[model samples]
Target: MASPVTRRESRHFSFISLPIEIRDLIYANVWAPKLQLHVFFKNGRLVTAACLGAQTGDESTGTRVPSGEEMTLADNRPRGWASRDLVILRLHSTWGNHYRCEEDWNPMPGHISTERNACISLLLVNKTIYAESIRFLSQHLEITITDTDTALYLNDDAKPVIHDSPPPMIPRQLLRSIRSLNVTLFGSVDLFIALALARDYNATTPLEVVNQEFQQKVRATMDSNQERAVGLLPKARQWHQIWPGIAALPHLVRVNLWMNHSSFDSWSNINERAILEPLQRATWSPEVELVVYLPNIASDNIVPGEQFNNNDEDGLNFRVVRRVRCPDRVAEDSRVLFIVHDMSAREQEEMGDQGLSWDLGEMSIEMDRI
Candidate 1:
């Protein structure tokens, strides 16, 4: 008779039954990845790794140069070849290589390993999850611009595949929704001038002429018998031209500018004040704050972990919050932190030893890290 007692099944609870705040925190913890968007202008295409995946180069994709036996030490490589494609930065083989200098192989540029699908996965979890996940991403996106190639846009054309979704790129509308921007601007006067000139020239020059000249140059660089690859249009845009659009973003609250080591031969040649004077004069709403990062500067010039005080009004209130010298890397590869006075001492303490942190919209600055 006891065998007749049937087993009852345990009831499953709905995740939505939890408080919205708790649900959101859970989503953030599960979806956190150092979501960085790498933007580069290659050929004529303005590519964002977050949208269209990072461009693949010869070394990265394992495309080997011709056998050493096929090439001689006297062979002349094309000029600006390495600049055009960064994959050749490493010495693949020592044989016949003229530059016998010691070579330390740097990892292939751009993000090699990333949780590229975390956000997408959360989006597909459910409708409520999708909304919350996307909102989280929109607020926390860190866009790192390393090249001023062409005008950047997030559209159907730039979208890449994600979980079979046709247009996986973050929507243009979503980009405009972002509130905080973190950028690493390589300090190079020559590069900036060239970019500015390119932009200026394009204003007067026809697009077709630019494309024609770009194609001709590309063709000239390749061997006559080699199959020509599809070339990008000539990009003539400067990063500064894009600044106005960025500043105008309705939600923008803060900007983090990291001054990377100058790509030029020596830092002594840079007129640091003159180069940065333009930005100092640039206007912004009182609500917005600017943080400047001077990486690898001498400790004697500026003390680390303390705000630099000129003790005067009307000057931009700049503070040195922290200094991080990557131990494994060269000394010049360190990061010196600076923040606007708008950020309180409490806020600086909260950000202690943490990598670039941001708070946008209703979200608190204590974001869940990957």
Candidate 2:
């Protein structure tokens, strides 16, 4: 019964003209393994980059960076595609010279192609395609909370001043869309030192003033236990501020909290229980899962590739040392998982030199579940 003109138009149908189910399959192929959404403040404006790798290289093209209007649209989309898979969060760029405390601290390096490709171009094909593709992307979007400073500022209620200015906070709508989050947990002393350095440093003040303040604090930490305890107070307060924001995430499925190895000694001093108290105390939905990666600070000798049971508290070769239940949860509910990786002193030094956090890939092979 079809007319000749209708038949001709059907014959010339484009990709978008296909059933949405077929188009979604094609989109999944293009976006398989998912893309990391790198959200950070650049020149005081909140910017995001979608890349295929752990970090977004300076050489990435503009297509990888979605426009502000596009981000707004993505945020306002209906919330049907909430992800249930494990989402790993990793930083997109390195923290540049924090010791300097300069206003323009993280300057982009000269472009050098990393060959990291992204399928974001598909979003620009057409409005209908954009809606479908973005929704698909949101289902598996992994967001990186670059540092503790940013994490503390995540809650809209939090208004802490850092580096003589209010630190950039993640947008609430964007936070809701995130399925995975990667956060770095700094050592108490290191975190406290950074906060002190940033808060005290002013462009108007002489450079010596900042240096003297830093040196004095370092000496106090070394000389008096009281000073060290005082310094650690901020770390606790910051974590308290951080937990509510994380618990408020409606669509979050997995969170990877990486404890910096350089601060292993300091963290060990504080005790893992105290450090993670805020997170453990916060009520989490049964669908949400948390993994804390810490350096094995136990005196026991742990050999790599050795599998130990979760209940084996006496074993030295255990990969997962503890699995504490979240408060107000049933006996059979999901618990917070803590993974400890044994790193030699030299290896710790190497990792610190490379970056603030170690990659989960390096620990995935040895990981065992309860």
Candidate 3:
């Protein structure tokens, strides 16, 4: 008689063998909910790293906004409320300082807490997993450009600021793969004073005197226009530098322009044209979406009349206006869609139950069809 053979039950599960839909759900659970990346130049090479800061309005963590001087640091810390579910990249200096450089991109230890670690190692498991992970990331990734140096670096025609041995180049494949981008047009608070001086100066008046008078006025009144000018004056000079690189991106599905100025009504026709005209001429595919988040201003500045009111029973917290190409003007340019969103509403939505309380407001913009 032969002894009964004992068989072992296999405990290992094949992740790749699962249906793709099931695999995707696992990927989503393992990966960061939203990956916040900052694009800038490092050692003459284009680098995209995780931004450092608490998620915006994350009161539970008790992280306060960085001071003005700290805001100027090269680490790309958030100036105000930070975005949520940001996955920190190991390449950032802050991350390198705290953790071993050899480690993979992971959420900062003390920052936002996470239940499970990001399974970035799955990319190394095999070729199929790598391709699938890349595909998943391309769809969820968001790149943010906040500095002029990065804008210049993105521009192919712009001269290299760094005289390093290797010529500056953003990886062509990476640029093509990016589906979403966030650009902040507000360079600095000082830009407001510059714009104000430029607007009030007369040829006969000495520049210094004009500047002094304006400073006094700002000190006395603390006018909203001064703060609003932050988004206006820099467009013509800086937008072109950034636009070329943005337009050249072949696969961009959405481009978000953050205009941090206070009131849309304060924008002059010239300034409006300076901003919108370039967008109208973008070389991207017709399906590309453009969303401009206007500054949060008083209700008085936003709702001029009843016509602009959206009449939402929810009390008009956010107003969304879509711009579509007119039927007759189809031949003039590609059929690009523009969505003007109120920043306050966006912030509230992002912050969830913890968002700042915003006063009700309505805003409108009139524009010629693209």
Candidate 4:
């Protein structure tokens, strides 16, 4: 009888007495979703999911893990929750956004999956846990924006309205809390262009640097192929609209831009110079790094069964070489370049962009290649 009473009393001991690092590790294990959490506004309510397909699936058929069983196995098999945590999407005043709770979410409709439940059970357990967990989870997870429209707009009168002028999908309250954000420029470039333009409008862009000599060179390049010339103008105009938005994140430290192949395949030295030159000239606060993942280049000339990353002093670099080969002499080499954070608006003025490299292809450095 005493043993049972002892166990019950131990559960009520202070959790705050543990070291902060241990407490933080516990918070991460309990709250951070294993995969990217997709946040968007649906029917005037904020909805988040770990799996992208979960966004459209019927909630009635979704899996629900009870509070105590979140880490347990089901049907003689592990539910893969060993590393993943549910992304609860309920609106709360904790962030100070003061989003109005919808009737569908207030009572947490029966059909709503446990993954969508506002797991404030931990928050309810004690105020100390709530304060420590919120700050840790907010910074640690990598949030991906799938659809910009849903992220940046609020549903009003059955129509979506930009949350604020020049529109940002993330709430101002949560902006300072996030450290990493990823946005893919897969279909449309409007949102990205807006971001880039907002970053540095006054700097001289390549599109705007057409002098008499430059025009002559452009015309000569186009003389060999008139069709290429015709397409350049519209495309340049589009990119000019994007780079600013990339540079304008108010409180971001890192951003990843995944660009489609066709969009950048035609970029010549001149075009690449234009897009990058302005960045070197512009200034950023607390410095924000941008990693541009260009589509892989198709070339059979690449060495097979080889993959490696480079220790470029300028910035972080990676090169992924594959094994198989196509019938034709064409294969894709996925490479990426990094733009390091500019320390300040003034520091960048003297040092330029710090990590501007033109080596887009595999470098011929004579060293051990992975």
- Each candidate's TM vs. the true structure? 0.46, 0.48, 0.42, 0.39
**lDDT of model 4, residue 118:** 43
lDDT (10s digit) by residue, model 3, range 216-294 = 6555545435544433334323444456577677667888665433222222211322244445555656666776543
What pairs collide in candidate 1? none
Alpha-carbon RMSD to native, per candidate: 17.1, 17.8, 16.7, 18.2
Alpha-carbon local distance difference test for all models = 0.39, 0.45, 0.43, 0.37
Runs of candidate 2 exceeding 4 Å displacement: 1-16, 49-111, 115-127, 149-174, 186-188, 192-236, 261-267, 300-370
Q: Name the runs in model 3 displaced over 4 angstroms.
A: 1-19, 42-127, 148-175, 189-238, 261-270, 296-370
After best superposition, candidate 2 residue 188: deviation in angstroms?
Answer: 7.2
Candidate 3 structure lDDT:
0.43
lDDT of 3 at 243: 65
What lDDT does candidate 2 reach at residue 84?
A: 12
Q: Ten residues in a row with the worst lDDT in model 2?
A: 324-333
Q: Distance (Å) between predicted and true CA of 95, model 4?
A: 27
* Off by more than 4 A, model 4: 1-18, 51-127, 149-172, 188-251, 261-282, 285-287, 297-370
Off by over 4 Å in 1: 1-17, 35-114, 125-127, 149-168, 187-189, 195-237, 261-264, 271-283, 295-370
Model 2 error, position 249 (Å): 1.5
Error of 2 at 126 (Å): 5.8
- Model 1 Cα lDDT, one tens digit per residue, 1-370: 4454334522345687789889878866764544656544444343345422211121111111223311211233423223212212221211111111112112234524333433545556688766776677677765555433322342123444345434434445555666666554442334332332333233346767755654454366442211221121232233434555555667667776544332312222233343344345445666777676543333333332222323422465333222221110101101221211112345345444454333221111112220
